[model samples]
Target: ESPNDHINSHSINNSINVISDDDVAMEDVIDADDSAAKHEQIIVKWICQRCTLVNSEHSDRCDVCSSPR
Candidate 1:
């Protein structure tokens, strides 16, 4: 196999590995709402009451779901 072919097969093997470290990490990752209560770093962010998506204090609407603040 050419050098390029070896690299392609290695990448394909890595992609096909379901139990890869990256896949495990992605599965363990917590979403915004899940960590929102734990990570209260942003005290000034305007939390949209409608969608609960956080936005800048200056914003008049939610940045994620686009609900009016």
Candidate 2:
């Protein structure tokens, strides 16, 4: 191919590569956000009504009598 054609093709290829890299980075960021949200949802809190005791942030039941929160 002619020099000008070769240069244009290389430029186009570089542009495509840059765009693909950006898309991958953006996807990685979105995945991280989704993972953080899932972790937050999995953490449950329990507060005892009788003695007013707050259990661990990850506990689903009160520590005193195992009552559902």
Candidate 3:
């Protein structure tokens, strides 16, 4: 190949590598966000005053005693 063609191909390869690296980084960020979301969900439980049972945020009443949250 000509020198100019070799140089152009090298630069194209470098660009492709940069793009792939960016995609991987973006996926890492997305995975981190999902993990944070799952942690938040896990931490969103409320303690039942009547029964002292740990209930999820989606529950309006105590799971064990039916006490209002």
Indicate which candidate wins on TM-score.
3
For all candidates in order, the CA lDDT equals 0.46, 0.42, 0.48
For residues 1-69, could you state the per-residue lDDT of candidate 3 as single tens digits?
677865533244212111122112111221332333321111356777777676767889888899988
Candidate 2 off by > 4 Å: 1-46
lDDT of 1 at 51: 75
The segments of candidate 1 whose C-alpha lies over 4 angstroms from its true place after superposition are 1-43
Off by over 4 Å in 3: 1-42
Cα lDDT tens digits, model 1, 1-69, are 677856533244222111123112111232343333332122345566777655666787778887876
Q: Which ten-residue region of model 1 has the weakest summed lDDT? A: 16-25
Best candidate per lDDT, number?
3
Question: Please, what is the TM-score per model?
Answer: 0.34, 0.29, 0.39
Each model's RMSD to truth, in Å?
Answer: 13.7, 17.9, 17.2
Give the Cα error of residue 44 in candidate 2, in Å: 8.9
| Tens digit of per-residue lDDT, candidate 2, span 4-55 | 8655332442221111221121112213323333211232344566565656
Give the Å shift of residue 25 in candidate 1: 28
- Lowest lDDT sum, 10 consecutive residues, model 2, at 14-23
